[model samples]
Target: MNEKLMFRRWLDLASQNILTRYFEGEGEGSFAELPVRVRMISRFRWFMLAVFSFYGLAAYGAYQHSGVGFFLSSRQSLVLFGCMLLVVLYNTFYNFFPDKYIHNRRLMKVQAFFDLLFVTVLVHFTGGDVSWAWPLYLMVTFEAAILFDKRRSVIGFGFFASVLFGFLLLSEYIGVLHFIEVPFFEDHSHHTPLFSFLFWIWVCMLNGVLSIAATFLMNSLRHENREVRTSRESLSKFLESANDLIFSFTPEGDILYANSSWHNSLKYDLKESHQVKILQIIEDSARAKCMSNFKRVLEGDPFRVMEGRLVARDGSLIDIEGHLTLSTGPDNSVVLWAICRDITERKNAERQLFHLAHHDQLTGLPNRMFFVERLKQAQALAKRQEHKYAVIFIDLDRFKIINDTLGHAVGDSLLKETASRISAVVREIDTVGRLGGDEFIVLVSHLHDEEDARLVARKLLKAFTEPMKIDGNEIFMTLSL
Candidate 1:
């Protein structure tokens, strides 16, 4: 390829989105607007095309009338039209090119350069040293403040505008270039060469100052507005890394966000949680307590710690102990946050320990310690109501002989059968317990007389009359009370 072809290929491959970058904010921590920014820049391109087309038509009309009202000669009008077409050509070229991040910022700078160059031409043709179009320079400077580094905006746009405008005015004043005079505006060409130099210096210094001021002011406002975005980002990252279940919910019970630990422990899909209400995840038995706490949080009475049961996605209950707090969101909406540890295994272990301590493991019957407590309660109730109560201590006869011959397992089956038989004959309010090996006890209360106690004892003795079927062996046992 030749040098001209290589240069043309380079220009065709270039693409930029300065307007998009400015709207999205220029650098780090600037996401969440990428998709919206893309569409905005697409519309801005059409707007720029409309502006170029409008000016092109104006120049074309002037050319047809030989500088009639627009004060454009044949050559100047063609030059303007041709210059617009150059920008249009590049703009059209970029439309067909795909945009992606190669991390090159030069594309924006190059586009800005072209814009400044084109505007310089317009400033000179419309009015020179006394140009009414100087505000156009500040407009581009404002854009530079947002989309480019502050230091670079000062040099690239501010100093560069001064150089272009100064060169144009100085050239025209020195008679090196023809100064086109607009019809109504005073001819600045007749002004002294020193006046042009002094005007350039004034413009140059002012650009530097205004560019710096605009950059700082814009940066301050952008940082202030970014507080919400930064807070959300920090919360997501910090909460997600926690081992405890962490979550946030709206005041209306809608779950807003849940960390990975929360979703995993609950067996819930994070993506589907938007439709799941906060109280819906709590176990049915615990919903009332959770709702009470939820209301408390809304009322600014959040708890320091609480115990709750959460219903998992698979309909299993999970015991959790945690703390909940009320918080204000970026939109000033009230929200609740929680950090909970899974206490399911620990709670299960506690229940198991209680069962073992107060019940007979082999017979699955209340043991000596529990039976004694019930005896004390029954004594107190009988005294209060002036009723008689009786305690029967029954021992199985020949229990040791059965265990030695038929084995301990068979012996255990006999004891369990005995407990069940006794329980069936007694009133529901009565207590039956296995005190120890081959030893059982019963509590009979609300008796009318000595005759009532005798009747219950007779019923107990008859319960052992039937043979017990244990481990496919039949055995007869008698009880002594």
Candidate 2:
């Protein structure tokens, strides 16, 4: 069993070695530079040499009656071995040279022509039509299919093999060449015409069919390869033409690639792109968060959607939102990839909506809801830090009466003037708001004492004591505190 296993292993290795060039040596290039066909041809020659040596040695041993029943007679084997040796010596010149003539179909056809003739010789010595060696003719045709670029060349070689095989069989049947049948098998040295005809048909059909099949297979593979290359190019073009900022970075924050949108927005050219880093474009307020998220993803966390402001070329910040993908690059290095959309316009729209929700539509002061939230925030601060703060409330006396008699235009004008006066009286850290119907509130922070609040209230009342000119109508508005 061990010997059987070892023999099987040897056969596998030998077959792989012989076919290595056919399967792996053919590379992408012009036909003239396709070096694999050269290697394949050399490998085929070497394999044939090994077969000849093995069979010749066996035939020599059988000449002494000590070998297995698998070899031709001693005289026949000697002649065949000598001829094959000359062929090998002739092939040696080709092996030592570069494969510059592989593209030359005439030279390739010549090689196939000689190879078929030698295979015919192998069949002649080993038993002519009845010899298993006849199958080598088909293998030669297959080799031609691989080496020749055109299907017509392969078919031509196959046709040539059929002619050589037919001549050998017919000559032996008619006694032109002495028929040598297999010694181990039943001898058919004087085979009938019908048997010779049938065997010749089988050999020719196999060679022809194998030739067509091999070429078809090669063409299909080439078509598939072209399709794959085209698809890859299409995807590359799509990435370059996309509107969103697509980018990739290394673990050290070095920029690997940035699409056209990213480059144009950052105002970095192709030449300067290599010098730009990911952190350089990150808004300072968002840098720490961005780095933290990057570290988390590097440590095996899933991809994260990062929101940060990117500094543009004109010193303006763009709100960018994207998901970061962590992948292992070549040699297993960490790569951070992102496809971020510039959300600056979207963020600006959201801010406007927020302002409309929280501020007065007319005067742009904080509305009732916003003022209450700030009051609570101030209340929490005062409690936490013992901070002094106060809230002052004021209402315009008989403001509705002015709206009913002099019209709402004058009433709106007076309200607008009052909001500005109150805002002007408060500190920058303070909050001013309107509660509608000529009512307003102020949040005063960092106060010294209760007396400070009274002083601010008095300052506001004295400022409003002067009449406000609204729509060219002077109206004295008294505040009810």
Candidate 3:
């Protein structure tokens, strides 16, 4: 149990080291969340499978040519089978073991050394460096470039492989290890000893060039990959912490992704809005117009400031102003990217300012400017319809006296009450405006005759008969038309 625990701790530490080396400071939601060691192991597993296939085919070809079972005969042949089994066992252990070493550089170095030794034995028994399996040495050098930190390490691994090959060739030339006569290279083996030795050494030097070149190329690719990951990390941090609502949607209006600000502004949790439709956030009355603009944007039009009311999770409408852009995703699918800013407070302030400019502050009634515009509109309608409309100007009697006696607070309350009473007496279609202090205008449009205006004036007069209660005091008021 202690041994198992120790192995687990070692694996965990190894994985953490690999992550720090490859994925540290990577952006949120990046592929960096996957363990680098696990990714390396996954790639290495495929390399092992390719090696297995190559060796299996070589053994089958040997058996077909020699008319002898490759694994059943000589010690070298048995060792070849043993190497194949080792590859299989290693892959299986990596898949099944409770504590597997992943991207463990030290462990890989040891395995690579053993592989070099095993290939050297195979090369010696199969008539030295002319063996077709010589290219497998380059594979180890490439793996070294990917797994190690420097180009020197890759070259060192390649030199180790070559040295083992050289020692095997030297042992065979000196007759220290008996060279098994293989049928395939029988013609090559009949060459003079001196020429054969020089040729084999030359072949080893040629393989060293190939190994070095492979390492150089692989290292360049690794450098490029690291740069791309760094750029991605930087971009991800910017998007994740941005205050604007940054999100993407599919062409069909389905929400594809949303950032932290989007969730915060919309008051929806990440999981809750996973499959939400983009149009669902827009106010019902504005959706048709918004969708039209969205379609236009997707059709290659540049974005304009699109103002819409978005319904939040709490069912409050938020005024949002932003633009949408069409961009292709990493997967080459067209997506509509959006960056919307919350302008609810700004919009509310604008409405309040507009109200202040056009309406009375105390009475909540249209001021002089708005009342004049309404009067013009009413006159235009009356002229178009060939009808008469009456505009009755009113001034409250004794209002200044009441204001002076009761203070400005009571005066403001009485003004509000007067506006409400005048509003109640007028028809919904008529305009009742507070023109100025104690001055009002009632525009009765589409009236049939002068008598219709007098009846509305009578109603306004009677509405003031009920005394207004202000500051716990009932106060009487009157207005003249």
Candidate 4:
């Protein structure tokens, strides 16, 4: 019993080795009910049955008529036909109930070995060196090459087929096995023994060489195909994971492809993005300028960074900086490719800095620096156009006394009210700015005469006479011009 168990273990290991030798990575999926090895075995079994059926009918018919197609005697031909039929029936049953037996690599290897062994037996009985079934060995070699993508497997199966055929010839020649009759072709049997043996050896070697050559060519093609597939997958992943908005568009402003960031920035979902036109998201005011830039880029001009506004889903505007390029589309026509980065925060910060430089943060009015700049521009205009402009410098009376009597909050409120009152009295072309403390300047430009400045001064004085309200307190204020 122990010897039997040991023999079984060794047999199972050998069977597994044979199966894996031909089908290394064909099908060993981790998340499936059936293994790929079993499926391949079933397919190989069906393929063998088809080949056998075609040859069996032809050989049996030839044997029954006059032994013209096959070299086997009538009894031997019948036996071969019966054996082939039995194998076909067995495979058909196994295919119907694959779960009945162990459908694993080990079992598949045993089935494949038996399949070759039977073919070898038929070859020996039919003709040995000159058998019509010799092409079956090439079929087996090609099957192994396709199933196993490795060079070693293809070369191994090639050499194994050659060795098996040589063994059949040697066994019969040395009397270990016996041939009942010569081949169906009578004239070939009269050849010298040495010449016949050499011819058979040559035929076996030639089959091995051809099998190896075919395997090498097929393996090269498969390798190239895999490399191309991997490169395409890598490029797709890069596009999906990019941070900037990357997209392709037609010359007619139709969007073709948009990546993850592109859809997300525009507040569009995957399904909605495909239907959106490229021009729809652009701000109405910037669309014409943006399209002009797009046309220039499409005309093969060098690309440059562009600034524009994009209207978001919530009806808010987002400032974006973009880079554009041109490429061939699916129809070989010119298409535009663009990468847009959200620069909304950066643009907001820049606007804030400009406002702070020229305006007072407390009263939201133009500051002293802006007043000086406006005065210089007025001086230049008066020098050039011979037009008169007046700069009115006003000071609030007793503002310090009011601030000391009340808290600073009331003073700030009073200053804010004073700024508003002064701004209200100015003309559209006039500039009003705070010069720190209670001093303010009015730049009245393009005035017709000195009387216009007096009218503006009268308006400014009348604006404070109504007793201004400051933080729920009615405060009387006066200013001197």
| Candidate topping lDDT | 2
How many residue pairs clash in each candidate at the backbone level? 0, 0, 0, 0
Candidate 4 lowest-lDDT run of ten: 25-34
List candidate 3 segments past 4 Å from native. Answer: 1-76, 95-103, 184-188, 240-243, 256-264, 272-275, 285-289, 378-392, 397-401, 404-408, 425-430, 444-462, 478-481
Estimate every model's Cα lDDT from 0 to 1.
0.77, 0.81, 0.76, 0.76
Per-residue lDDT of candidate 2, residues 70-126 (tens digit): 545678767876778767876776677635455555766776688888888888887
Local lDDT at 407 for model 3: 93
The lowest-lDDT stretch of 10 consecutive residues in candidate 3 is 25-34
Error of 2 at 391 (Å): 0.9
Better of 1 and 3 by lDDT: 1
RMSD to the hidden true structure, all candidates: 11.1, 9.8, 10.1, 13.6
Would you give me the overall lDDT of model 1? 0.77
- Candidate 1: tens digits of C-alpha lDDT, residues 58-158: 76687567744667688886786676777777656444441531134566566667767777877777668776767667666655555464466545687
Q: Candidates sorted by TM-score, descending order? A: 3, 1, 4, 2
At residue 87, give the lDDT of candidate 3. 63
How does model 4 score by TM-score? 0.55
Candidate 3: TM-score? 0.78
Give the least accurate 10-residue stretch of model 2, judged by summed lDDT.
25-34
Show model 1 residue runs off by greater than 4 Å.
1-102, 149-154, 186-190, 214-237, 371-409, 420-431, 439-466, 478-481
Question: Candidate 4: lDDT of 113?
Answer: 56
lDDT of 3 at 294: 88
lDDT of each residue in 1-481, candidate 4, tens digit only: 9999999999998888766544343345411123443455566667667766787687568766773444456777677777777678777766676665443434444444556677788787766766667777777666555545567766776787778877887777777876645544577553356855786678677777877787776667666666766887898899999887888888887888888887777788877776778798899999998998998897777857887998877678888898898888544988888888888889999999989999987788889998888889989988899889998998999999999988899988888989899999897778999989888889998888999889889999999899977767888999999
